[model samples]
Target: MRATTTPALFTRPRNVAASVAAAALALTLVPGSASAQQADTEPVDVRLKVADAAPVEVATTPQAWPGELLEAYGVSVDGNDLVDVVRDGDEVSGERKRLRQGDVVRLTDVVKERKTKRERVRRGTVEVFTTELKPGVRKVVREGRPGTRVVVARKTFHNGEPVKYRVIKRKLVKDPRPRRVLVGREAYAVAGANGLNWGALANCESGGNPDAVNPAGYYGLYQFDLGTWRSVGGSGLPTSASAGEQTYRAKLLYKQRGRSPWPTCGRLL
Candidate 1:
């Protein structure tokens, strides 16, 4: 014998709500199968009461489901289906939503869904940078390697579709080391111990003017002082000396001190 339940809950299909209607065939509520009954202690109890008509008998049972929930919708459940539940209701491309064995026909109190994404920021960490030292190198200095900033974006979704989006916020993710450049600044060789290239030395001293004389009594292409010129075996003013004599004396000075005598300017030589 089929059992009857009242005050059932109705469910609308995912897409349509008002499309349900009376069927051409009589929908008879049948008793559940033994398996359905075993799955539920209550058994698959389903019974239908039609207005001005006697209750009818159908076959099979609802698969591990509650059939009483269909009552309030005026749907007569014969097993898992209702009579006249066909595929000719809502039109799309000249076709209606087709009904299959396990289709949900109706729904109530359902909420529509839309997808969206939001962005957020998180704090970043600072890092250290080191420069290697090489031979003839003096000391390594550290100035602190402050990091830089980066921009990022995030997207959210609703109902498997994008609805709303924005550049919600900024985030810091990396701390870079301070700016560092490897440099060389020290000279280990004895000043001027290496022979000087005098041609370059003359250009720096006086633009190679053999008659060049400074206001301070320094005279000649080599900018020789009076005493220094005589010490180098040159008599009289160096400007009065021949270019050959002046060059000879300059060579002597280079041999003695390498180039310490012309420190800053000798580097070109």
Candidate 2:
């Protein structure tokens, strides 16, 4: 036989099992492999609540940010709106946090508005006593006038509902005018006339004017004529005498004639 050397081409590996194991480990350590990528971006389930609306479930990656998730979910947020995140029953900063499984995202809409309104100020009453008319008589000297004011306020709304209101400014537009009333305190000693409604009689005769004078010779608060005034012991003209004296004389006349001196106004007494 000729001395021929066989080639090592058909030689078998000494550690074939170890070589297969090393190859499998190298495949698992690859950075761009499907298993590695899937592990890095695992899907997470989260809940999103926006401005009084019902909560909705969303599926996102664990590394996703709050704003990015909202944008992907078609949720728009304004500049004044607020966003909060809750995880494991505790609240966290939405801006600095990433989405996690079982996480809750809350969105609140905030709005501020300025309003103005006109308000009315009620007027007061002032009473003045005078002896120019009989007791218990009243006269309106000046009518009351209400004032006006403008109020400015700031209203805050959360989730389209009013939350707080604060007054910013107040301006007085007009001052209120008080009502002036004149009351009577005159006294009389007539038996049946002192207790009569002399005020109504005066108002019916002379419109409650103490210096009233009629063209038919009637004068004073009671509109007494010259003859009737003298019969009641009145010396000067009824219009020239004081209001107290005129009332006294009218009472005396009423006691004598029993309201027959003035036919038209006697019904009032």
Which model scores highest in lDDT? 2
Local accuracy of candidate 1 as per-residue lDDT tens digits, 1-269 = 11123312122232112212221121232233233344333323333222212333222234423233343233444332222222234322212323233333331121223333333332233332223445345443444444444444444332234444555445454554444344442222223423456677788898999999999987877898998888767898999988767877777667666567777786776
lDDT of each: 0.46, 0.72
> Can you tell me which runs of candidate 1 are displaced by over 4 Å?
1-196
Give Cα distance to truth, residue 192, candidate 2, Å: 34
Q: After superposition, how far is residue 2 of candidate 1 from its true place, in Å?
A: 99
User: Candidate 2, residue 156: CA error in Å?
Assistant: 2.6
Q: Which digits, one per residue and each the tens of the lDDT, describe model 2 over residues 168-201?
A: 9999999999999998875545556677888899
Clashing pairs in 2: none
Least accurate stretch of 10 residues (summed lDDT) in model 2? 1-10
CA shift of 92, model 2, Å: 3.7
**TM-score, one value per model:** 0.27, 0.46
